[model samples]
Target: MSQLQAEYIKRILSARVYDVSIESRLHAAPLLSRRLSNTVLLKREDEQQVFSFKCRGAFNRIYKLLQENPVSGVVAASAGNHAQGVALAARELGIQAVIVMPQTTPGIKVEAVRAFGAEAILHGDDFDTALAHALALGEERGFPFIHPFDDPDTIAGQGTVGVELCRQHPEPMDVVFVPVGGGGLAAGISVYLKYLRPEVRIVGVEPIDAASMHDSLKADQRVVLPQVGLFADGVAVKQVGAHCFEVCRQYLDEVILVSVDEMSAAIKDIFNETRTLTEPAGALAVAGMKRYVKERKVSGQTLIAVTSGANINFDRLRHVAERVEVGESREALLAVTIPERPGSFLAFCQALGKRAITEFNYRYADSGTAHVFAGVELPGGSDERDALVQGLTDKGYPVLDMSHNDTAKLHLRHMIGGPARVPSERLYRFAFPERPGALLRFLSAMGQSWNITLFHYRNHGAAYGRVLVGMSVPEGDEAKLDEFIAKLGFTGHEETDNEAYSLFLR
Candidate 1:
């Protein structure tokens, strides 16, 4: 082994985390085990005092900093779990701490940091912006900056999780799946496991939208993601750390990318097993493990996944529940064109034949054909969806499968009740502050001139409420609509040109 690897092992072994950190439990996931046809274990770091494993690394780093010399205070920038980690660690160590979080961060996280006895400051729109502002403040205040996941001490501190894993699981582990964001936790655990149990494979899981580690590994170097999905906010890091990337490249067997739907289903799975709702990042390992098992067709092997944290807000459950069925292949969405004549709807219903229709929307497109959007629950999986599609095709009904259409899933599904009544329909998506009376603010601006033909907005527990608005604005009145939108001052753009709108609405 290289000298660097040896040093990491030493740091992990001698980590001074016992003062404030507990060895999180490794528990059986009976539901997941039965479903996957293998023994499944979950490292329950969500059971930590802060409901996250981040405290281990934060405390270890803080403890060492105190041992080295006297320090004024520590400052860190984070949108979620890490902020809580530093705050709790600083409180236990009797050191002052300042945590900077993004202005867009959910209210629960910011309040939790302050409750932990740290000074919480909300600034900027996202974590990167908050991080830059925090560094500047740290420099001006002469307080040391505690990086969320980039530093050596932080990575080594997190390595202790692997120590506990090795002690808990003496039996052969086929694979240990870990979630990767900025790569600190994955590096810390994988390197240690590679040293302690060379036979075990380490797989890193990341959301496809925020696959910084996966992209970096593919390029054989660190790469910054241009944009990341905010649904999985805990792992929405744009880039990986330098040292963390090096260690991961050396130790990680492979990195798997999962979708938002898969992560949602994993959240449901973990909830069913442990009665705990984990954040998207926390459930990533379970999601990845399932995908790996299915793709490789591997079975009868013991698999372990780290349930990293449960800092998710309660309101996000609706979104998770909505996507879980599709992610698990238990639901299929379809677009069908049938005759506009009477009794055609009845014929379609008879053809459906009691498959339990989850959702249905229909609107007259013309005198000849009517367009319908429908979702069906499939207990028998993708084969059922295929068979139904073939049956419909054989019956001379034109069908378009929409299960994989993101535009249809995220926005169009809610807007499915057909086209606008008036001529010249234009649709726009708007993002408004998610405060009480926010929708009222938009409506008050719209006035009574244009008829709202289509509107889809359901609260999804986000800082911004997404609204799909279809307005019947007559030609030559476009400038007025533009003027109104500009004066409204909300962030939005026209979705009229989107193909989904043309297919379903126009």
Candidate 2:
């Protein structure tokens, strides 16, 4: 073993998280195990006091700070779970703590941090912005700025989770799936497992839209994501931490990217197994594990997935329920254009034949053909969705697969209106990590300068969400659009030329 690996194991062994955090149980999911024909185990970190395993690292780092020397206080910025961890840890350690959060953070999270006795300061519109404010405040107040991840002490603390898993299971793991956001949890678990249980394969899971670690590994260096999806908000860091990235690059066997639909399905699976619902990020391990198992087609092995956190809003469950069917190859979305005449609808329905229709929306177009956005429950296996699309196309109908279209899912399905002759309308789609006031932040960015022509927003029960905003931009002010979007600190694109937008709302 490397000398650095030895030190990491030592730190994990000496981690004092028991003072504030509990040893989360390794729970067996019999249903899941049977379904997959493998021993599926869930590391129930969501059962922690803060409903997240972050408390372990937070307490460990603060406990070390206490041992090293005298400290004034601690400060951190988080939109969710980490803030609660730092707040409670600080209170337990008899030290003052300050937490900075984005202005758009949910009220529940803000209240949770305040309840733990931290001075919660709301700042900026996103995590990156809030972190900047926290660092500045820490420097000004002469307090130690506690990072949510990245610090050596914090990573060591997180490694204790791996230690507990090995102690609880007492068997060699075939593969372990860990969520990768800033990469702290995966790095910690990877290092510890590599040192003690080298037989165990450690794989990292990332949301496809917010895959900083996956991108970094592909690049052989850390790479910053231009934007992160909010569907799995718990692990939505735009850039993997420097230390966390280095450790993961060395220890992780591979990384898996999961889609929002897969995450929704995983949430349902976890709920079915344990009668407990996990947030999108919390269920990522299960989603990725299932995908990995399907691709590898290896059965009768031990697979472990960390159920990271469950700070999901109640309203988000509906969105999950909406997408779960499609995510598991149980459903698909398609835009089918048929002739605009009587009996044409009946002909389309007869062609689909017994395949369940989950959703269908159509509006009259003053043209020869009419477009219908349809969602249908599909049959089993991966190729079925493709075959269905192909079958529809072969039936003398022009079909556009809308299973992965942002415009189709978020707006076109609901707003299937006839085209309007707006002279200067421009459409843009923006994606941001979802919190309490995410829409408000977008509106703030919009300001009162432009006339709003049309708008659509939907929450897909993931850490990230998207908005389609239509504005009337004058010819002379077109140059300002790029600058405005760049300054928003989130990812967005112009969809004025999108066929759906042009056909329906433009």
Candidate 3:
């Protein structure tokens, strides 16, 4: 073996982490295996004492530092898992630990560090500022700064995970997916796995919005990202560390980038399989592995994904739940246009026969045509979404699929409702089936002689779909409109004179 390989392998074999870190389980994912037709395994490092694999590297690095030379205390800067890891390790060793975290760091993480008996200092607003302050503090206090991922000892410590993987799985393996943030974990795992197995492919996974390692690998040099998405905050690093990049460049077979939705879907997948919710970063390897399996159509191969941490903030779950469907291609958002006439909305609903309508919103913006923002649950995934769009376009509806539009998903849907002025307009509130043909049948019975101005419908996971409709009647048609509405076979009432409508939608 080459000296570099020999050195890291020896270091990994001798690393001191068991004193503070456990050998996490290599769990079989039967459901995921059946879905992909592959033998999928998840390395559950999220089950660590700190609920993260970071303690392995942090403990090893600090333990080794003390062995070579006596140190009274240690200092480190991190806003997430690493801070907790370092503080825990220092406490175990009976040494003082100073952790500098960003002021914007969640209170949960700050309190977690303090719980580990470390001095938690809030400084700056972001990680970079906290890091600078930590470095300066270390110098001022004459204490060693425990680098999160760059140091040789740290990488060696993280490499222990690979040692356990080989010992535990032992069977033939096709690929191992490791999450890359600053590249430390990837570097450590990739080098050891490649050296020991040589043939097993080691793939590094990164969030597309924070893909410093992937970009660096492609460019054959380190490149800093201007900014990174914080959905997976644990791995939202702007640049890969120098030592980590060098090691990963040599050891990793390839790097995969995944989107925020993919990660969210992956978190859901992990939860479905293991009954455990992991932070977004913890699910990166699974997200990348799923993408790889889909892109390559590879089946029956043994694949492993390292679930790195579970330090998720509770509030992020709602956002994750909202985006998981789109991430998995199980929902499609659409913007459809129909004529601003009485039967047009009914015709639109008819075109969407038998498919569950998830959302619908409209307003009387123009007299000639109206735009509708809609969401449909896709039982058939992307293929169904494509067919639905094509069918709508073929049937003369101008459909713009916003399923993949992040901005539209995040903001445009909520911003779609507002006041509009329409002369002789009458509004009605109605409830119909949340299912396929209820709206179609109700609107069909209501007749198409008058001009339909504004409409809104939203499915709230209930049996009934609530709708608000506005119609233009030429004074004489009020009774005619009421007569048609009374026979529509659904519960509804006129809201034209309602004070709330006058205040908001008039």
Candidate 4:
């Protein structure tokens, strides 16, 4: 082992964590075991003080620093968990601490630091901005800056998680999954594990959209990301720390990137399995474990996934709940363009068969053309969904499948359908060929007598098409409408009173 690795292990073992910190429960997860075909153990570090394993490192690092310097206080910059860690630790140690945070940080987190008795200073808009301010404060006040992840002391302090993991499980763990942000957690745990138990493989998980560690390891050096996704706020670091990178390069067996969808799904899984609502970063280890088992084919081995923390924002849960179906492949969004004809709408509905309509939106203008947005619940298999799309395309409709469109899945569909004010209005849906002059034919048949009220549509990469049209008419014009729609011979539905339409597309 290198001298630094040896020293890290020594520091971890010699650290003075409270007796309560030494023993976290290691419980088997049957749900994960079934999915991965391996015995999966969860290290419940989310139950720790500050609801994160960060406290362990912060406590140890501050104690070690104070023991050495004695007189100087500590300062740190963080948006959430790290700030809580330093504040709680400093308060426990009777040391003055200042936590610099971004002005954009949520109110809950700002109050958390204050509750821990740390002087919380709101600085700039992001972590880097806060860090810059903290650095200036540290220099001006002659206080030691406590880096969240970079320093040797912090890395060694985090190694204590590995120590506890080893002590808690008697059976040999074939693999250990750790979340990577700035690579501190991965570096510390992997170094300690590789030294003490060389047989165990260490895998680091990162959010796909904010994968600084994965990119760094791929480039064979530390590289900074131009932008980071904030969904997993705790692990949305733009760059991996230099010291942490060195340790990670030597000890980490592999780095895996999980999509925001996967992390959200894992968050739901954690809640279901342990009744714990972990933040996206906290669920990363479990998500990585699932990916590792599939990619590495370690089906029979005992695996451990670190459940790092549970400080999730309550408002974010609604977003997670909305996308969980998409993440699990249970929902699909499709854009279809159909002939702006009467019978065309009915034909499309018949093609959809019995699938539940989660969303339906459409727009018609320029007299002839129309665009439609539709979402459907999928049956069991990818094959089934593909067949459904193929069937729709075969009927001369241009269809665009967005079952995996991240943007649409995250924001668009939920806001597409709602109430509108158009009395004597009848709503009809149709599928048409996305071609020049398709709408002209339908509008020519409907004529200028009927007043069109609402129209909305977009292309989603489909050959065939779908659209929704709202028409306002005189109360006694129902018979005239039936004759007008019958002349077009397009597949469609008079959805004016359809309960589904009223609820989601009124």
lDDT of 1 by residue, 194-284 (tens): 9999999999999999999999999999998888888878888888999999899999999999999999999989999999999999999
Query: What do the candidate models score in CA lDDT, each in turn?
Result: 0.85, 0.83, 0.88, 0.79
Q: Sum up the clashes in candidate 3.
A: 0
Q: Is candidate 3 or candidate 4 better by lDDT?
A: 3
Which regions of candidate 1 are displaced past 4 Å? 418-506
lDDT of 4 at 65: 81
Clashes of 1: 0
TM-score of each: 0.82, 0.79, 0.90, 0.81
- Say which prediction, candidate 1 or candidate 3, comes out ahead on lDDT: 3
lDDT: which candidate is best? Answer: 3
Over 174-280, each residue of candidate 4 has an lDDT whose tens digit, in order, gives 98999998777888899889988889999999988888988998999999889888888888788989999999989998889987877887888888889999988
**Candidate 2 regions off by >4 Å?**
418-506
Q: Cα deviation in Å at residue 236, candidate 3?
A: 1.5
Worst 10 residues of 3 by lDDT: 433-442
Query: Number of backbone collisions per candidate, in order?
Result: 0, 9, 0, 38
| lDDT ranking, best first | 3, 1, 2, 4
Candidate 1 lDDT (Cα, 0 to 1):
0.85
lDDT string for model 3 (1-506, tens) is 77888898888889999998999999999999998899999999999998889999999999999999889899998867899999999999999999998886767778889999999999986666788999999999998999888888899999999999999988899999999888889989988988889899999999988999999999999998988777777887788899998888899999999999999999999999898889999999999999999999999899999999888878878789878888999999999989887788888888987787777888888778889998888999999999999999999999999999989998888778568878798998998766666666666776778777777776666788888888778978778778878877788988889998888778
Model 3, TM vs. native: 0.90
